[model samples]
Target: MLKSRLYELSLFLTAVAIAFSSSEILADNTSFITAIIVFWFFSTLYFRLRVFYKNGNTNIEYGISYDLSFVLFAGPLGLFILETIYRFTVYFYRKWKKIADPNEFFDTFYNIGTFVITNSFVYFLFQHFHSSFQSFPFGYWVLLFILVCISSYISGAIMVLLFGTIGESITFKEGIHFIFKDISFLDYGKVAITNGLLFLFLQEGKWEMIISLFILNYIVNLSFYSKSQSIQNKLERDQFEQMAYTDFLTGVFNRTFMDKKMEELNQTSEKIGIVVADIDKFKRINDSYNHAVGDKVIQHFAATLKGYLSEDDYLFRSGGEEFTLCLRKRDFSETADLINSILRGVEKNSVEVEYNGEKTSIFYTASFGLYFYKINELTSIEKAYIQADELMLQSKQRGKNQVSMVNGLITKELV
Candidate 1:
């Protein structure tokens, strides 16, 4: 999910680069450099998405990349002005300033708007300059270069703000500090290679350098992508293991594991109780709002039971609208109240969820048929289960939303 989002931001930048027709100066640095940068964004996005598919998630260098992109933008006049204002107030007149941090100033809506407007205008300016002044000398391009850098930083910083923290504490000095602090030779190699290729294309007018840079960037991104994918795959495998024992709807253990666990519990203890709990008239809920809402209710109820149960207590999905709990105990009567307490907590829960677009809330009551017994009384685990199951039916028959007991008499407590 995170990678998908990061990729989306890159795509947006690529579109903007295209919109301004920043790739017109085939004879100069503008066209090839613009193409390379756009490619970088797209390739990064592709790598991220690819990683997401092969693995689940990854830790990315958001701050480093954002700061790099911001440096690219900060070279422009817009951030220069903001930085000038920041430098003046924070550094020159540190005593008089209401906001002393450049980061705080950068995060303001005004700075954000300026960044956006200037970025757009700067791209428009580049398209105009590249088209109108493609033959302009390198000595005369310093002003435009500054503008483009600021635009790039604005675009990158805004992108960072969209996905990450941009706080008052994050200053230009801090950003520069981090640029070197976590310096990766890999990134330096990329920068060197990028500039080398661009210089070749511009200074030496070698068309082949463009292709070389493209390949180098792709190869570099691919290496990171493969490493990220391995991490993602590991995360997914762990998630699968978790889900195998968990309910998708309610985030609890599913019925299969619950039943198997009950058998294990029966083996160790002479006294054990199996409570098969079902939500009363559950179909009504699914019919009234939607299955999604019903699912939310189930999830909420399941979570409630899970929250209230002891570590030794185990719960699972028996089926739709049904749950099975293995109540392990040496004395059936002694543990009955504990189960009752958990039931009361479930009754008290209300589920809140969003379905389609609307928010919905629901509360449900459950019927519990608990089979209590000593391990030796029943023939095998299966027979012991059958006996307990029979008693549960008795409880269900007597009341739709109440606990029925076997091997010991117990009263239902309504909380």
Candidate 2:
């Protein structure tokens, strides 16, 4: 189902309203805590500029700003202010660099609402459980910290799932899967360790720990960014290599791939089988209908050929209306059955085309020529192709839809 832009906008506005309401209950305190929060927020922005990580459909940098806001402020109002500052800073930075994407403009509100709502609930739970932080044991403090992290993650995940489903028609299950997959253990560990360390520093009144932790966090973010970039580059290279060996129209192996496979086979001493086939009256189909309909017919024929191939077989779109199949470790009878099955499938299938608002169906068939031989050198493959091509011409001459087999270099016609 497609989602309307107006609906998405309405949802964003409603979320912003809720977050604003929640921020009204926060206690206003302007002191050293506020200054430290501001410093950490800007430091997060600086590290964010150095490393941008893609999570699901959005790019989000790992930062301690959210953790700092939740741990230091302990109030809804302060968390809201810190979240607003961080979001606007990132937004203006993108605008100044002329890299602002309008599609992502709504994310600022969504993220703010998520942080305010989740952290506010965590603070409420923390207050309910602990009578006073002064007398709380260290073990209890650690438990409370873990609870905050888990609850914050869950609440944020739910918000993301809700917004994603409303905006993009993504399923709840898919959203959950994406969220879990995107949040690596490293992300959780970084947040837990940094926030825990910062909490202890505040308790001990140690100001120097701030700079040390910031540098360490930045180095870790940089390392993750480099690893992700390397993986992305390798995937792109593999895609390009695949495209080079694939037929774009038919989605089958191309002539170049066939050549490479033949070369590989030449190095082995096993017997190989080759089948060359061409659609009967393919040019007539194009001339009568149109090139579009001809393409549909070709795609259907390719699918039919693919259905008859085994795991050890390879199919290639050798020409406009011609295909070549390579079969290994198959005897003459097995090869004949496979070739006959392909011919039968092609004859039974039909291609549907729409012309001038009306639908028409067309059926087509192909002629096959099979050659089997032992591969000793590259020339053996070349010779097999020549023999198969000649035998295919014989099948086309005998009839338009029959198999002509060259058994052990002996020409034989099979219907």
Candidate 3:
């Protein structure tokens, strides 16, 4: 945290210094500078061409600003002014919108600081290249292309540092991979071409044409940005829904989803098999090893059950060390066969857990109580669930690892 703050402060101070030192180069025509700043500010606000990617825990969101051309034309003073105005405007805009962002405050400073410093660096390079190469051997277009690529590379580095500020530690290899993952050479060429055109019109004092070109670019960018945002919103909704219904540790449907599903099933006149299964001597596992090992065992048990499920079957972690299986489109005999096979599979498989730096296989068993019945108006799913749970308790009382139903034990013994 301290390091991040220091880095931000350094960048901010350096940018301010550069802006102040270049005060002499303020454009003679104040109106041109004003127009540039206004366009740049609005472009940053409305035009965002963003690409999203996932690299492990890091979510890399890359936006193609294409503002480098204008920045180069504006110089240090203009760059700093534009960045400051845009950052502050965004900060206030979010506040007005009642958006609760934890990092918004730091982000405001970080963004302005980073952009000012980076663009100033790029501007310096542009100036150097322009002076050194009077008539470029490889042509000016190729030179612009190379500069844009270099700018992109630098931007990626700054993004990595931003991640570090937020406490996301990534390795150098991962950083490099992140930098190049979604970036296209074609996009870099687009940046070069656009900037070259903008620079040409600016030199010829064709402000109206420059405005037209910027408006065209903005329209194109807004279209793509809208599509990207829509896709991103849908993905976020799906992820949120999954998280709501899924057990955090076991990766199965949680009790909340089970209840909702049961309500839906009760509305139908279909026969469903409800199997309530509980790990035998589960409390002992937590006491003997640790909660971490206990969690491992639970995950392994859930995976084993999941492997046995067909398309018509659903498994849920209804309680701690307890799971519920709903078998649709299966008769009593078929359900019995499946449950018996699961019982045998549980006995055959063992979970490997680490204890005191030593790995050991822990063989365990589970008891199940199945209630096969057709959903009707007379019997509510809540009542049926209670009946299934009571039968599971009966299995627990009958000396642990066995399936008990209304008729009695399916098997004489399961060890």
Candidate 4:
């Protein structure tokens, strides 16, 4: 906690120093500063779009503000003034709607500081190499523009790395690696194109071209917002579908999913092995203890049974104290050994419950019935289910905790 505070304090002090230095530069370009501020205010009011990206373990939100300011070649002071006005405008709008964010100032200060520092560095480099830069050919301006964009990116990245590593378990190097992994060539291309267009308009001294570009910028930002919303909505729908198919109690597939999967399997001609298992005397445990303990027992049993299944196997909680396992590409002979192992594992495992401040241990067992047939051989899943259930009743009649197999061709009992 102390380290986090220290980092924040350092950030504030650096931002303050940069703000003071940039203000001095702005005083010299008063006419251009006023014109740029007016342009920035309208741009901020018009283009309020944000794109979100997941960076490793963190999520980052980007707005068009930076791109807009960069394209205008807004030096440290102009960039700082533009962002300050934009932030204030947004705060007031939200406040009028009675939804003001308390953290707005913190974000505003950080962003202004980042812009000041990055653009200041770019200005400094340009001044230092102004003589050599003047000697460069017109075609070489592209190379200079690329260098400026890279420097700005690196400067902003340093701030991100510093803050991202605070209160987290990642190193600076790892954070850089993760952040850069998401940065693509397209990002650079966008920056280059915007910078080129801005430069062209400024060279031609065409105010109308600048106005047209501003409109295009707004449209591009709107397109990005629409795309992000569509992606987010699709993800939400997929999540809801997953929840609908999942069992709330044992975290296994529920009856709805089981039925859906069976329907899909019916379309194929391959044979599938089916096993229906039930907890032996499950109602007695509920009567002896309580419903809570009974639920725990069912959960434990379901989890244990699921562990023995292969990748191609599916386990479903079809009903209370009852589960169905569907195996693909496995015959009755192969399933027999697997069923016996599960029966033994259950007999050895016990569920512990607490009642009236006293700890009690409860033991339980399960019965299984296995059957296998080609999809063409079975008329429907209900017919296969009836055959497996009847065989399970026979196992219970012989004695509890056993597997019974009846496939019309072979009848076997395993104890």
Candidate 5:
């Protein structure tokens, strides 16, 4: 935290130094500087693209500002005027709205410093080559592209430095990847072309065209930004919903999702197999070992069951040691065969866990009860589930580790 504050302070001091050195140029081009600052304010207010970082829910937004174009037309003093006034204005506005925390003030200082320094350096770099290459064919556009690339690199380096100061140390390659992860080269190209055109128009005294270009660019960018925001919102909603409906330990659908699916299945006329599976002697496992071992055994058992399921099957961890599987697109015989195969699979598997500083393999088994029937108005999913549960309890009574199912009046048990 101290390092970040000091880094911000250094940037603030350097920007102040640059601003004072160019104070004399500010008065010489008052009208031009005012025009640039006005447009810079407008762009800063409305035209920004949000780039999301992969680390978490953090994002950085950048505007399609006229600052770079101002540097091209009116030099470093123009940038100093634009950034100093515009950023402070935003700072005060955020403060007035009760949104500016203590950190925001420091961020404002950092912004003023970095914008001035980076743009001033870019201005000098362009000027160094401007005179020699101005007469060449397409040299101006080429120079603009080069300027854009170098500025992007500088911006990325500054970001890496900021992360380092904040204790998020990253490799240069990772920093570059983070910078270009969401933003495309085409977006950068558009900025280069837009700023390049703005520069030419400012030179030719066609200020109305600049306003028109700003409006057009804002409209197009707003459309795309709205679309991107919609997609991001949808993704977040899906992730949240998935988390709410998932079992944390087993990574399967939980009881909440199971209830929802059961209601949907109740409304359908399809032949369904509601299978209730419970780990045999789960209490004994916890008593002999620990809850950690019990959880491991449950997870391994759920995984084995999942491996035997088809596309039309949905598995849910409906209780601590109980799971429910909804099986479809299979007849009675096929369902029995699948359940027996799952029983064999569970019997063959063992959960390996570290117990008392020693590697231990705990073998376990499960009992299953399958209620197969076509859904009708008279038969509800809750009723079917209760029937399956009763059959599963019967399996437990019949020495456990077996599947019990009823076909018509005959009750069959598979061990």
Candidate 6:
């Protein structure tokens, strides 16, 4: 917590210095310049604080504006305008799902283009608003914006070429390790930052300032790039930890994840239903055929089951031959039909394999046990899970390849 706060303060302080320095260089009084900087920088810091406080998720809290500096904002009003536009763009894309990459590139390429375009546009608009900078032609301003955008794209693209998705999220601490991970992003940031600074210096047609700014951009990008690599390593390690909770073969919750998710669902207002399933005579298949064939049968069984499920429902491989499904809505009927469809699908479809110099078809089948309980009322989610497990065992006893309900209300015949 202290570390995050300190980083936040550093960002705020750095941004403030940039803003003040820019105004000092301009030597133009726009009446309310000081107030604007205070408002803009503070507002940015405030948003950053709120983000860290509310969503502590690393991806959500600092991924967006962590690297951006104050000079990038131009002014408080400019900051507000850019943020509002970016936020709306994000919300619209997510809400309607119509938003797409304006620039076509895969992975880190997309972010490179996005960041460059945003910076160029913001700088262009902010410059146009400045009365002192009005001497420059609109076309000249546009040309400069395009140049800077292109430079940023190329430089940031370095990160893409080097580390791929690893370059996307870099904090100050991580910026150091970026040196070894991908120096391209460093070059990119350097060129972009320096180019912008050069443009500012060349406003007075000073050759030395232009050269100095150019060098500065390179140095800065190199430094940040180093940190970025370090950060990427940390993030990757964290993601590894997250994946530990997920099943390797199925890409769903493992027992560890299931326990955690069930705990969360127990605290919710809505009810959660737990369904347990097992492949009928799975051991016989492995014994009679082979584990290799058995594995294919398992994959086929899981794939069929996936088709019957709703988006909200979850599928899990509890162990070899044993499966679990968590149904969010719907009563036993819906879950029953879905599970039954999966069973029928598995029965109808067979995986063909060549063994002992002969080609043959392999069939797989499963039995399901499902139960639902009010999530709001459950003292524990284990109640539903245990009952569902017992019900699954009961299905094996009643007959193979059928769904049994443990909720005491609805049950289905296995045949």
Best by TM-score: 5
> How many backbone collisions does model 6 have?
19
Off by over 4 Å in 4: 1-48, 52-60, 64-74, 130-181, 207-225, 263-270, 281-300, 307-312, 330-364, 374-378, 408-415
lDDT of 1: 0.54
- In candidate 1, what are the lDDT values of residues 199-266, reduced to their tens digit? 44544545466556556656776777778879989999989878787777777888667766666765
* 31-116 per-residue lDDT for model 2 (tens digits): 44654464546465454535555544555544454344343433566566666676677777778888876655666655666666
List candidate 2 stretches off by more than 4 Å.
1-70, 73-85, 103-117, 131-190, 207-214, 263-269, 348-361, 378-380, 407-415
TM-score of 3: 0.66
For all predicted structures, in order, the TM-scores are: 0.43, 0.72, 0.66, 0.70, 0.87, 0.49
Instruction: List candidate 1 stretches off by more than 4 Å.
Output: 1-238, 353-361, 376-379, 408-415
> Rank by TM-score, descending?
5, 2, 4, 3, 6, 1
Instruction: Look at candidate 1 and tell me the lDDT of residue 170.
Output: 55
What is the per-residue lDDT of model 5 for residues 145-262, given as tens digits with 9 covering 90 to 100? 7777677667667767888888785887899886555557776678788989988887777868888888788788788889989999999999999999999999999999999999
lDDT of model 6 at residue 213?
Answer: 45
Compose the digit string of candidate 6's lDDT tens values, residues 240-322. 97799876766666788777777787778565568887888988988987887788777777777677777988777788878
Pick by TM-score: 1 or 2, better one: 2
Q: What is the lDDT of residue 102 in candidate 2?
A: 69
- For model 3, how big is the CA root-mean-square deviation? 6.8
- Per model, state how many residue pairs clash: 11, 0, 0, 0, 0, 19
Score each candidate by Cα lDDT: 0.54, 0.69, 0.78, 0.68, 0.79, 0.55
lDDT of 1 at 343: 67
Candidate 5 TM-score to native: 0.87
Worst 10 residues of 1 by lDDT: 51-60
> Which portions of model 6 show Cα errors greater than 4 Å?
1-238, 376-379, 408-415
Which of the predicted structures, 4 or 5, would earn the higher lDDT when compared with the native? 5
